[model samples]
Target: MSTPPGAAGKGRSLSAVSRDRIEQHLKFLVGVRHPVAAPAALQRACSYLEDTLRALGYAVDLHGFFDGGQEYHNVVATRLGTRRPEKRVLVLAHFDTVAGSPGADDNASGVALLLELATMFKEWRPELTLQFVGVNLEENSDRDGHGTGLRGSRALAAFALQQGWEIEAVVVLESVAFAGGSVRQAAPAGVPLQVPPNGDFLAVIGNELAQGVVARFALAADSFDIALPVVPLVVPDNGELLPDTRRSDHAPFWDAGYPAIMLTDTTNFRNPHYHEPSDTLETLNLAFAVRVCQATAAFLLGMAGGEGAAPS
Candidate 1:
């Protein structure tokens, strides 16, 4: 486990997450974002998030990169820790949707939750820096995830290493907020675990290094009164070493030797509209999205050494 020297501080998540705010962010992201095809639209979407984070008093950091000859942008909103500003915990989600889809649950939900957290914790300064990142170019299978596939995340991970920032943990939210009435989630093939018959639970997948954080994440959900059927997956290797687990932005952190975990609703494994045009806001389960934000607040607060005393 290549973890930083800091320990998870005893603290509970403070602040109530507004469902309305979550909804608005989701609408704004999914309704406005365009993928590989529309550069101008994608830039506009990035600007939208950047402006919102700025309004919430977060210093927005843009990491610009090029993919397949097209320049892409990643939006970072940071709330530096008062006690350990040198160490950081990253919360990231790609804002760019795949071409031909609206991407409500695919990722807009992820960014919405990230935005909500940025707002929720804006004033509650923690002991570790919290970076809410809206990454881009994550859906491309061509980037080899550990290297190329994760455009924005790969760059951010490299930048953190170059700057010698002590990364306590990196949490990536993807395909969140799509659960209802006994939904059964299936783990990727060969990763042995009997998924409940109902795919209604949220999944937290981590590498061996992230085992401890994953445990706390489940407990945090319960502590925050978010009754999610949370499933914690700890890959025995550098998750990127395995094909099944290296599925999202979190994969790059593991490749960079940082402890990272992903919170997800398990895209195509459950939702039929995974990358289709039908992946719109109307199909999303907003109530489920709210639970994700609440649970995330709990996990982040504890990780950031904030005021909440979640379970050990």
Candidate 2:
């Protein structure tokens, strides 16, 4: 996991991602977006994501799949690379929310960051193709009879595998907003992992295959002066022993043998409003999300090729 040159510097592209833009995205997306429970809201969210990506000059594609004779969609916006278009990197987040909760921090934060990255790199041609994917039905664990969640991501992973796409990395964002100086943080009970006392940090979890990605994110997180710390955890065997680490879209890419990692805020471990009705936009820390966005931009730019590009 060699660090990209100048990896410990603030992303030059950070100027393109702003706190206001993130809030705008969250304001419209932070709601109960379920396929069955709130289909209209779900569709509206999907349309908004598509339109936003399209406005950013991305050729958005609604990748569709079916489960039990029902159809679902994954919004994919591709940014073709100039140096190596064959190899690709994925920046993805799920948009669907769990029933009864608005899921502001649970996922709207992640989706907001995804859109921000899309805008940041809209005109910058990287070395590796970047795909910003907004997936659906990530939180449908049992409410909709969807067995285990991540159906959208699992389907996309399978589609990528079937197409034989050369995936360089998959960066999944999951609940990346909430952070506080005094907020309590804890790992699952009996996991033996030492968590920070405060939640003012980001967690980068990956499998052995994604150690390099996790290391890059940790370095990027520290590169900026945003009071945000990064905790990098590389689990063995795709986090099979620690199920909490597999609770996002990255898990599907890991299962498909692609190097993948998740950027998160340790959702249920630190956020009391997680999966509750109180998880609204007002409770989110936009500053925290901006920091995450900056670090992620640096990380992705470093991975793509370099930081020197014409302003998008």
Candidate 3:
């Protein structure tokens, strides 16, 4: 990948230390058993995220609720913006993994990226208030047996609407660690590929409402020397779908009538170990993860106007 003009000699790239942190986070997730019926492991993961946010100077809030007599909580950390409060930008990633899989690439990768970004934003706030949300129940619900319903994101969106919160753009980081053969932007079943095969690049999948947002994010990604495939398209209603677009935590945001996009490594379509017991930390492309995080930080900083702005 070509290096951006200004990013030639910036601070250290996400380091070995950071990669180690990501691995540790994945290890923690794999060590836990977060079933759909009872989510004790999910709660523990939330606690870990909460502590990390607190250490980064964010006042974390737990939106706790009950469903089927089981407690579900979404961890939210807010950093006030220096310029715009009414207009906010949301950075979301679901913390809860699948029922049985270790989910290293399925979602722990996304959560690690979120935590890393939280650390970066704590030092440099954005012009738009930034809300980092770690959602629960992205997996199939015991009752509905549907993963696309997105119980946690739906609840959060409803609550935000009720509270009159203006969400300008929502960016959902889904899977970021695994990398394999060329990456392709997979649309729903019968839909054409939005972009080319280039697994080294990030794919921004969204609808027409978020087309401009996806463009801007792609520009920012390019500015950071990140070659991301920005695919702005509508999802088809077909039941059979490409693996990349079919599985992720971003679908909820789009379903809620908000402008949202998912950043992923194409999941099962590209990763051989996806959703399998062998999906361990050793299989992750740490270099790709570091580059992805760097690109994400650059995009946020550019959107916020500079590194001096407080993280929103």
Candidate 4:
């Protein structure tokens, strides 16, 4: 793998990945943030995300749409590219959860990292317009998730297309915490690909159009301060053959013919607490989550044309 651009010469420090802040964010977000189940918590989550992005010097936009006669929101923060303003890159995480589950690992972890990344890249001059989006309603109201759960992302994709935006990449973070243990990890049933048995690695899964992005992320992970084990999987036909790969918001972008990838911990495959009330802050590994931020910083730095060093 090629060396990640902007990696430190001798040593890399994860100082930019603030563990305390990530934990704080997670603490505030660890609740049943469903519109119907915990509407207050869900509104609070949206406001917090918007306030955080505004504090980071971003012009935040609340993309609202009506679904089932109820208004839903997607928090979007845009940082225009310095060199190539037309090219765009997005980092997003869904902020809503199932009815009963607090969704700490299901998505609070992902939201915390998304906020941290937005803070880390605030001052960077990347070639691609960096967008940090907090999507809502990713978790379907139905238990089987066969309904209109991805409406937020699908609407955003359609809006991007309407504006004729040139999207370079879309990185979706889903259930990124809960790593490092003796418990064995399992691939989705009947999938032939070989994965490490231990639940110690982050899975970077992409569609055929996102092959290069997946490879670049793997290289970026290698150059970070910590040893972040990554399993890079590229699927054909936009992961139609493996339904498990299409579980998150990135699936909608793929449907819009845009390049997107999902960074996850394999969800139910590794996390026994998936969609359970037990998926709380105490169950997450914050250090592992910090490492994910560091790796993502490296990836964005490389995409910035290797012009300047990443935050310390």
TM per prediction:
0.89, 0.93, 0.83, 0.94
> Which digits, one per residue and each the tens of the lDDT, describe model 4 over residues 1-312?
123344644366658779998999999999899877788999999999999999999989999976667888999999887678898889999999998799999999999999999887777666668899999888865333467578789889898888998998899999999988685698887565788989998999899999999998887677664578988989997888898999999999998889899999988998889999999999898888988888887777766442444576
**Which regions of candidate 2 are displaced past 4 Å?**
1-13, 142-146, 190-193, 224-226, 306-312
| lDDT measured at residue 144 in model 2 versus the true structure, 0 to 100 | 47
224-244, model 2: which lDDT tens digit per residue? 544568888899988888888
Q: How far is 11's C-alpha from truth in model 4 (Å)?
A: 3.6
**If both were scored by lDDT, which would come out higher, candidate 1 or candidate 3?**
1
Error of 2 at 57 (Å): 0.5
> Which candidate, 1 or 2, has the higher lDDT?
2
Clashing pairs in 3: 125-309, 125-310, 125-311, 126-310, 126-311, 129-312, 130-312, 183-198, 183-199
Predicted structure 4, TM vs. truth: 0.94
Worst 10 residues of 1 by lDDT: 1-10
Worst 10 residues of 2 by lDDT: 1-10
Report the lDDT of model 4 for residue 172. Answer: 96
Per-candidate count of clashing residue pairs (backbone under 3 Å)? 14, 0, 9, 1
> Local distance difference test, per candidate?
0.79, 0.85, 0.67, 0.85
What shift in Å separates residue 242 of candidate 1 from its native position after superposition?
Answer: 4.3
The residue-level lDDT of candidate 3 at 235 comes to 45
lDDT of 3 by residue, 1-312 (tens): 122234333342323226666667677765333555346776788889888888889879998765566677889999877677677778888876655567777688888888878876676646677788888776655445643546677788777777888777788887788764554334334556545555565666666666767776776656545443444444443112544464555565565667777787767656777667777777888778776777676666655442353322
